[model samples]
Target: MSSSLAQKLETRAKSLGFDVVRFTNANLPELTGARLQAFVEAEWHGDMAWMPETLTRRKTPTAMWDGAVSAIVLATNYGPEVDPLERLTNKTTGNISVYALNRDYHDVVKGKLKQLAGWFASQSGQEVKV
Candidate 1:
């Protein structure tokens, strides 16, 4: 992708409230898949049964869809203004993670991603999947 297109995508993502936006190819290193397999075999994933269930597809973007050639990564920050550790020290006050203090980020970020994906597909005339 051209630098101009990337910049436009970044701008659009930020407008949709994403704190960070990055672009990368769909391909992943073989070690990534190997590490995931090792982690799953070791039962390190805990209760996230979906991790193992989707292991094959999660190995690489292309593994899920062969047509995938690129990826648009987005991130949102939910850091607390005060140190989370400080809250932990105060036993009287219940310690709630910053993420829990606000609306569910899974819903929020997923909504934003879908909107961004729609806009990108319209602007670039390319199919997008959230």
Candidate 2:
């Protein structure tokens, strides 16, 4: 990707409240697939049958889409203002997963991703998928 486009993407991601943004090639190392296979073989995935079913695609992003040359990984910080682990000590408030605390996180991230994807398409004149 062009440096200008990448700079724009990073700026957009920051504006969208994303904490971190990274770019990497779509092709993962062979070690990744080996480790995933080992994890599955050990039954560590448990009931996540989809993990094994889509192992190939997951190991290599380009395998899922031939046109995808690179990947843009963005992480958003939607953590609670206060310590979530503090609930574990207080019996009155049951402990809950951090992700569960913000149920609408998926929608919020998806909307931002869609907006970034649109911007990327507009800048690169290429199709983008979030």
Candidate 3:
């Protein structure tokens, strides 16, 4: 993809609340698949049955979609207002995972992804998947 397009995508992603946006080819190293396979065999994923179920597709983007040639990575920071380690040191206070303190990040990020994908598809005249 052109740098101009990448810049536009990053700007749109930031506008949509993403803290970071990166672009890369869809291909993943063979070692990535091997590592995942080993992780599944060792039951490192635990109860997440879907991980194993989707292992083949998870190995590489092309496994999921033959036409996939590029990848757009997005991230959002969910840092807590107060340092979690500070709370950990205070035995008198109850501890809660930072994720539990706000709206579900998966849903939040998914929504933004959908919007960004729509915009990108329209701009590039290509199909997009989340």
On lDDT, the candidate that comes out on top is: 3
For all predicted structures, in order, the TM-scores are 0.86, 0.83, 0.87
lDDT of 1 by residue, 1-130 (tens): 7798789999989998889998889988999989989999999999999999999988887888888999988888856667778778777888776778878878888999899999888888888888
Better of 2 and 3 by TM-score: 3
Per-model C-alpha lDDT, please? Answer: 0.87, 0.86, 0.89
**Residue 125 shift from truth in candidate 3, angstroms:** 1.2
Q: Mind sharing the TM-score for model 2?
A: 0.83
- Model 3 lowest lDDT segment of ten: 78-87
Better of 1 and 3 by lDDT: 3
Residues 1-130, candidate 3: write the lDDT tens digits.
7788889989999999899898889999999999999999999998999999999999888989998998888888867777877778888889888789888977887988999999999888889989
RMSD in angstroms, all models?
A: 1.9, 2.1, 1.9
Give the Cα error of residue 125 in candidate 2, in Å: 0.7
Count clashing pairs, candidate 3: 0
Candidate 2 structure quality by residue, lDDT tens digits, 19-121:
8999998888999989988998898999999999998888778878987888999998787889877778887766778888776887988999999889888
